[model samples]
Target: MTEQNENGDFFLKYRNETLFNDKNSIVQCLKYFDKDNDQSLDLNEFEQLLKSLFSHNGNSYQIEMAKIKAMFDFFDSNKDGKIQLIELENFWFKIIKPTLFPKNALLIVDVQNDFITGTLSLTNCPSKHNGAEIVPIINNLIDTVPFETIAYSIDWHPADHSSFIENVNNRKLAENSPIKENIKTFDSVIYEAYPNVLQILWPAHCIQGTNGAKLHADLKQVDAKTDSLGRSVIYVYKGCLSDIDSYSAFFDNCRLNETSLHNDLKKLGITDLYICGIAADVCVAYTSMDALGLNYRVIYIQDGVRGVDSDNIKKQEINLVNNGALLIKSKDVYDMVGCKDRRPELAYATFLSLARSNKV
Candidate 1:
């Protein structure tokens, strides 16, 4: 039989072995699977337990023996070839619970010196919002919440970056470019290049190794390594290529190149991304949109973000909400992260993720 058929047969046989009634506690469920009544589950019994967990509401997850073996070994913490009630309890709380809920990450996007007070300061932008105002708000969240992962994205552009107004003459403008002659900052222009790109012109800022490229001094800088709380800190640098501009921390504007943010978050099993930062209409909006596209539950912290254009920020908020992102305030984050304020929208995101993986 083919592997698929074999897995299907296995599911058919075990789908009805155990029913997960709402009243059944973990201990009770373990006893139900312990057919031998030895207060422990052998590999076969453990497989049935996992099968039951994944099979629910007219869906049966395809079981892979190798994956099952690995999980079995992990939960068999003592390596006794069998999982005791205690080991099963650990599995229930640590693995199963989080799977049903979600693992969260805080993504702080491009809150740098240049955007706050240097050359490209938002105070000079259309909205004239103080970018520095978000620093303390983000810092408070960092200090209070025990997020599983925290990522900070920076605009690490090169001196001759195409998005910079000074370099507008370096590249040939596309024939279809809306504005070619007398190009000015904040004007949208199309470049004549492979996969012709449309770019917004900005003053030269965030040049590599420059002081403006540095994150704001007061912004909390968590070490880019695993901490004692098992939390991971990551720094994502975008717009490094002199040719292309990158707004989303995950991918370049043209989607030609990808930053390590996606793979890094995947490695940590990040399910939900709580995004907050500068330029809500630009980088922050792009990052949040990309996060939603990647199947993450996105929560946009409204007050924790500052934007360059107030009108565009409002439009971005509407767009994000229409695309399954939750618009929330910083005040509501604590309860949400602790899973005390379980929003149905977030739960729906979790369900959609499981459904896409064919695990529902």
Candidate 2:
């Protein structure tokens, strides 16, 4: 590395000056901040990391940008265009630790197969582990809501899904983790399996035949029986868009999306929605909030949903309550809509208490 100082003295030296007071921390921090495929950082990228650590009041994306920028300035001492791998070990890694640890926030973003099983996720999703308890609650909720229809966000990939390992052509064309790889996100990936430059995407995980790709077995039986599903029940599937990440049944994240649920609910004269699903902190929480925002009376069954982390659960629960979506345990609902003759396992009087509560 060579550079001309402010005094116009030209000197060439190594970047190992402050890489470490301790060697282990240097190696770890360098590995953490280096996200892009390239080994070097630019000024903009270096600031992104720095801003995140110091600036406590910003969104995740904002913090990410700042962190990226900070890396750029710290390593590119000579004003060079690119940073070498060794330069990262010298100066940048030292200050990067306090920057990388995430600040805790309370919000439910989604609970899905991709998240529950680490097959296709980078977050510490809490709901996946609690699947055992959450599933039965969902089953009970489904049974109780006899008149209402259900909308599902299933990732029904084509036989040759662009995201699958089976599609060798896609694997070759796409980078390991392309920014817009899925057909749902970028419509171009669907028809032409082989693209010019697919981004570096996660390794092939959720392709069709893979066990990690299938929906929960319980949801599958119900999904399979959709045609046989009660006439009163309606099902809408989202996330079928090859390039998009469809979290909500109503719309894909990237596109202006809509579903029949709203119109169908209006048809049935139902203004209230009992929203519950996997990963209470994520998709289930997001959908309920959107429902309340849309002026639908939203009721999120607490016992019926699960989150990936304690922090996610705490955040999502608060969001649900603030949005005017009533949060209740599963037993609470079973008691409310439950028939007088057909009682839940609980005592009859307990049922009345929930049924008569404000949630209804």
**Tens-digit lDDT string for candidate 1 (1-360):** 111121222222222314322324666767878889998999998877665555333233455687677667766778999998788776665445543456899999999999999999999999999989999999999888888888999999989999999999999888899898999999999998833677999999999999998999999877645355567898999999999999999999999999999999999989889999988999999999899889888999999999999999999999998777889999878866765444545534544454456441
Cα RMSD of all models vs. native, in order, equals 11.9, 24.2
Superposed by TM-score, candidate 1 places the C-alpha of residue 1 at a distance from the truth, in angstroms, of: 54
Ten-residue stretch with the least lDDT total in model 1: 1-10
lDDT of each: 0.80, 0.45
Query: What is candidate 2's CA lDDT for residue 208?
Result: 43
lDDT of 1 at 129: 93
lDDT of 2 by residue, 85-156 (tens): 566554433333212211111111233455445464424432335454555556655555442345444444
Model 2: which ten-residue window has the lowest total lDDT?
Answer: 5-14
